[model samples]
Target: MHDLIPFIPGSVNDVLGSLPFFLPEIYLTALFILVLITNLLFGRNSEKLCRIIACAGILLVIQRDYQQIQLLFMSGRLNGQFLFNEMLLLNRTAINFKFIIDALAFVLLLYFGWDNRLKSHPKGLSDLYTIVIGSVLGLHLMAMAVNLLSIYLAIEMVSIASYLMVTYRSENAFGTEAGLKYVLFGAASSAMMLYGISLLYGFTGSLNLFSGNLLPGLIQANPVAVSFSLVLVLVGIGFKLSFVPIHFWVPDVYEGASTPVTAWLSTLPKIAGFALLINFLRPFVYFEKWDGFDFKLALSIIGIITMIAGNFAAIMQRNVKRMLAYSSIGHTGFALMAIVTYNSTGIAALTFYLAVYGLANIGALALATYFANALDADDMNSYKGLGLKYPAASVCFVIVLVSLTGLPISAGFTGKVLVFSSVYGIYQQNHNLWLLLLMITGALTTVVSLFYYIKIPLNLFLKRTEFVKNTLIKSQNIIVLSIIISVLIVLLGVWPDFLFKLF
Candidate 1:
């Protein structure tokens, strides 16, 4: 082999440049390798040790990255493009908000490890943590990727990891079926996205999304083809976000996967997917100025359809996971409203909304998982009399459900208000009557959403069913932590500025 000294200078500069921004992922990678090796060498007893290391690694990343984010913003590196030939961008906006994302991942990771449901299967626990860390690292990369190739790779990385997490318990038919469905659908979507990427590259002669200036010309030349390519790409994103017309696999996967994995699947990837959506749409924000391209109208139509379809379908669901899956689809539409505004305030609102929404969803899923394990049922009917049997847990569930419904004095309400006001501002400036119609539709959907959301409390508190032994098993630390998150949800709703200030 050639002497290493010849490449030392260039390699050193690359390493140094990528070091600070990649610290969190690097830490995770190291911990993941350690966990794998320890499991192989030290046997099953070392599973808990791996969990501790994973949790510590994630927390350390969050703390270090949070400080790094502040420093980067203070130093005016918010928009700085670092190593890898500018494929990776370290922006203040992404950096500040991604710290919160990392923290959210830490909370979910802690819950995944500490939940008693997974404690008996040590090897599975280790494998699950490894997959989670891998997916989280992919998400971190996705938020910063500036090229089409990096974007596709980041998405596929997360997708493959998620498929494994869904199929971890492969002995069961549900796990096997969910895994098969996910891989088949995911592979097809990825292939379509790749073809779209190839078309864009062939038309533009560049793969760097930020620097590529061919979209306007291509759209003018062939509006239909460009729109086709855009839709094809959105198929991949829509799968992750679980939007209408591309959400057929979500309920199956959610119902089949274990509750903890389902919780992670529902929240973290969706947040990252939305962030990617906002980033991709930045160039198309001035669609009116571009010849023959009406991206805003297209997005508005999709948002409207997603909202109506998601809300109407959710009304018929009795399975808790299935209902939440539909509810997530509706929230996807709500989040897309912020994207339609296409301004700094809209981005900020979407970021804050996603943070709170993810926290609440994860907390709710944790409680749901606990109840499912305790009662040995995942149906809504099993929740009957839970209000009296498990008052604290049931109350926490109510708070989370209320937040999901966007009721007053909850983060969900603040998120909805922010999205509505931003869209309203856009409407006032442009006199777009369609926005007002959508706003009204969104309001009506929220009311409809409340009916389904309240079903949990109704069954638990109001309707009495066959009485079972009301044994009070001490709450897991994870459950208590989830409740604390619910408290933050309400606090952020009451004082919306608390999070906005960080960005």
Candidate 2:
């Protein structure tokens, strides 16, 4: 008891010190509460106020994130600092991830009500704004989490928000079904993750990944058990990433959820999941004696399979959103190629690639909303000749899809090149067969992606339809923002330094 007395003041000092680094997330919690209060105070009439508040709050969060970035660079603290008893990390990479997530989230918050179907919800979008704010907080947590307990909690927070967002349109039976599926899959994955965490804690007697006890304990434990536990944890992160076998829930969820919600589901969580994966893998990757799990081989196999499956399956989808869903899976695989490299250059490339991909994806889905509002079109067959009818929307769709396909003069192209170069650089040094296979698979899948992505433009511009049922264009906001995103994509592609310099 006497010895423990000194620890109390130290713990208090740690919590107090963590607050500054945690400013963005603290603001997010307050934002969430503010939005909820606005919702309750004004009921359905709170939509606009909630949106305005949420958007403004996110921008402030982004500003805070920017400041953190400056502090990291200016203070020469490139190695990062630990907080909350080393359960979380405050570092350049984590800060960058939070910045990207918050920046995209600001756009998404503005986008939520732009979807005609979502805008027509009887309960209004106030609840959605609240959920998104909360989720952003969770996403920030995921980026910084260094302890197993924090990781599980952060994931669950975001997962719960996702469930609510997917099922927001409860009147839509399809959406409700998708939400049910998401919850079921999410629960199973969470259980596996928690069990894995339990096993690790039992083995190491510590929750912190970087703690002195973790690696030493794991090195001494049964290798098979350690590997199994690690794989199970990946199961949870994989569910968020929507990669390969864990990806079955993606298409159905994307197709069934509102376009804006699908946009959110595909981008932000996946970006943060990658951040989480990097955090989880870092300690193991750096420990030279640790060979309990071959992360490179496992991730390479997963990447190769994910690329092939996502791109090829996309070719068969007629529904535009569903096709984008598969396309996202393919992108996840491509990003994994960067992760497997496990180097500074690879990490930088991954950050840029994910940012570019996330922007293009949100733009693509926004166009989906645009057409759905303009012509009630959702599938390729229904898209025939609407290109001429709505040339701006069609052109934006083409540009975004071009980026997704990694064609030139688009950011996606630049991103893919960076990731490819990073992997090849690593391959040159190690001559790993897995790296070579990943590069080959990535290239082949890029070509395969063209087949499906091209189908959109072909239907939009080539296939002629004489009859059209058109509606008032209520999706102007979505169109305008998508065009801006498209221009940014091209700009970043042409001058990769615009984004690369940030990293």
Candidate 3:
């Protein structure tokens, strides 16, 4: 019994040793608590205070993330350490993911209050800040999590935060309906994931993916059962990634939610989802002898199908948000191409691609807000002839769409090139059919994407409307942010190495 119990003092020492690596998460938790308390004490009066605190806290967290990178450099490149009794793994990849999440989150925190609809909520934006802080913490956890229990908890934390954000304006019936649908889909997926986790634990007698017992125990189990369990777990993650089949909730939710919340949904959670997926797949991909399932083949087919479905469906939509919603799903499929390679080059490309995609996606949506506020336009038809009146905003919108469409001299183009290069490199070595198919599908989808993306620019610059709105409502904040993002997209495109070196 004593041998089986092991030593308690050693575990305590291990936890104490892990604290330094966990400083970012600690600070995030502290920020979450501070924001919550501010919201409670001041209520509606705390909006500006909450935003200030949230943005400053994110900066602090980003600084800590940078420090973690320096520590990784000092320790030696690519080496990682498990923390909190092997519950989490800290590495260069995880740190990079956290940095991206925080960077985007900072933008989102500022944008939330800028939107007139969200700003006018009766309960105020203070609580929204608090919820975003909590979600950021979950995103950080998702990047580092190596334990099944930790993964599930991190995902649920983000999910619940998202549910609240989508329906922040409870006065809007559409928003309430979207929230209910999101909750329902999320609940079902989470339950499936929990059951899957339990099944995996039952088979392996452990919840840690990195533990010695997990792989060997899994290898000996019934292959059919193991595969079923893995698929169930993927369902939960798929919900966040919004891949086909599980992606049904995205169009409705994104359409109903405020523009800022739509930006948050399309970027932050999806970035974190990729990180989680990478962690989930690492063990199975790297294990020498385990061959119970073919992740490569499964992901490849899903990628091809997802890209086709998302892009084609996007063509039929005239509503700007719904179109972007489907476009995001298409982008999700394209990102999966990198994951299938499972190489260092592929991972680097993925990080860069996601960063660029997230920026452009956010910018595109911000422009939607700009048009909405200034012209009261929400669909493509209403955009006709407005380009001449709003030259700056219109040009910025064009640049963003170019980036999203992966056109030349934009970050999106560079990202696609890198993904193509990485996949081709893998194909050169193994000559795998799936790799070839992914590349082909990726290229075709890029072409298909052009049809819908071009619609906005055509309507803005080419199509003529008999009547144009001269009266405008000011939304300078959103317009400014969109212009900045457009510039970054162009800058990063010309100098891809700026991000490449970092990744």
Select the stronger candidate by TM-score from 1 and 2.
2
Q: At residue 183, what lDDT does model 3 achieve?
A: 94
Worst 10-residue lDDT window for candidate 1 reads: 469-478
Residue 298 of model 2 has an lDDT of: 92
Backbone clashes under 3 angstroms, per model: 2, 0, 0
After superposing candidate 3, which stretches have Cα over 4 Å from the reference?
Answer: 1-6, 75-78, 470-472
In order of appearance, the predictions have TM-scores of: 0.93, 0.98, 0.98
Candidate 2 TM-score over all chains jointly: 0.98
Query: Which residue pairs come into collision in candidate 3?
Result: none
User: Each model's RMSD to truth, in Å?
Assistant: 3.1, 1.2, 1.4
Give model 1 RMSD, 1 decimal.
3.1
Question: Whole-model lDDT, candidate 3?
Answer: 0.92
Q: Write candidate 1's Cα lDDT for 193-307 as tens digits.
A: 8898887777767777666565555654567777777788888887888887888888888878877888888988898887777666765664445555465676677788888
- Residue pairs in clash, model 1: 78-91, 78-92
lDDT rank order: 3, 2, 1
